[model samples]
Target: MPKAYFEPEYLNALVEVFHEAKRILERRGITHPVAVDAVARRILSLAQEGVPPWQILGEVLPPMTPEAAGLPEVASTNDIVVSGPAPDTER
Candidate 1:
């Protein structure tokens, strides 16, 4: 079987999306892992569509919580490991 690969650009996009998702979750005061995971998945989908990392924050995420409005904004991208390419469904 041939080995699978995650394209560099795809990996980068996924990383950026994850970062943005984390920030949105933090700003919303969402500490639940499940909720954060759900947001991360959505961010990946949007990132796959070539949505800008910064733009994804405003377009796809839930509105900022009132309490979060007063919090200082922080942004950072972290490294992510993509185990491998998605399995082919055509088989």
Candidate 2:
């Protein structure tokens, strides 16, 4: 899908809010890339609707968690299993 565009003034504020939200999520241990990207997209959407940066920074970001950020609990490498044909022991 095409990326959303923003006015220069809104773009600047969106960038600032995006970074601040990233920092907040990191501090809260929501460091998953999906969560961070979701927050950034949300910030831009809200800004496009004319929400101010201060409100986005102060109100919109504080309550976010991994679930709130819309990311499912990620499985660790050890939790993932690859299925394949069994080895040929008779060879």
Candidate 3:
């Protein structure tokens, strides 16, 4: 049997709302997919960060963006790692 076509539960939850939101925005000439998705992604990120659903919706609705909630900043590390040469073995 083929694997199911259904999206993972987590993905579906995130996409469904955004899909609806994007369509509404597009119909209103908000064709900038990047900005639309940016907003959706911000909302979803806030949800994943444990923001209360109501609070997230309220904050995202108007006069606010994800940055307004003062979410904890994520620290980033350099992608490249440094390594020293292998040590020589004594006979």
**Model 3, CA-based lDDT:** 0.59
Q: How far out, in Å, is residue 73 in model 2?
A: 31
Query: Can you write out model 2's per-residue Cα lDDT over 37-58, one digit (the tens) per residue?
Result: 8877777776667667767776
Could you give the candidate ranking by lDDT, starting with the highest? 2, 1, 3
Instruction: In candidate 1, list every pair of residues with a backbone clash.
Output: none
| Global CA lDDT computed for model 1 | 0.67
The global C-alpha lDDT for each of the candidates, from Candidate 1 onward, is: 0.67, 0.72, 0.59
Residue-wise C-alpha lDDT for candidate 1, range 1-91, written one tens digit per residue: 3222235745765576678678767766887999988777766666666665656667767575645577665556676767989878996
For model 3, where is the 10-residue window of minimal lDDT? 1-10
Q: Where is model 3 more than 4 Å wrong at Cα?
A: 1-8, 51-91
Candidates in order: C-alpha RMSD to true structure? 21.3, 13.0, 15.0
- Per-residue error for 9 in candidate 3, Å, reads 3.9
RMSD of 2: 13.0
- Give one clash count per candidate, in the order shown: 0, 0, 0
**Candidate 3 residue lDDT tens string, 1-91:** 3222233654565555566666656654677868787878777776667664445544554433435555666557658766998677977
Model 2 TM-score is 0.54
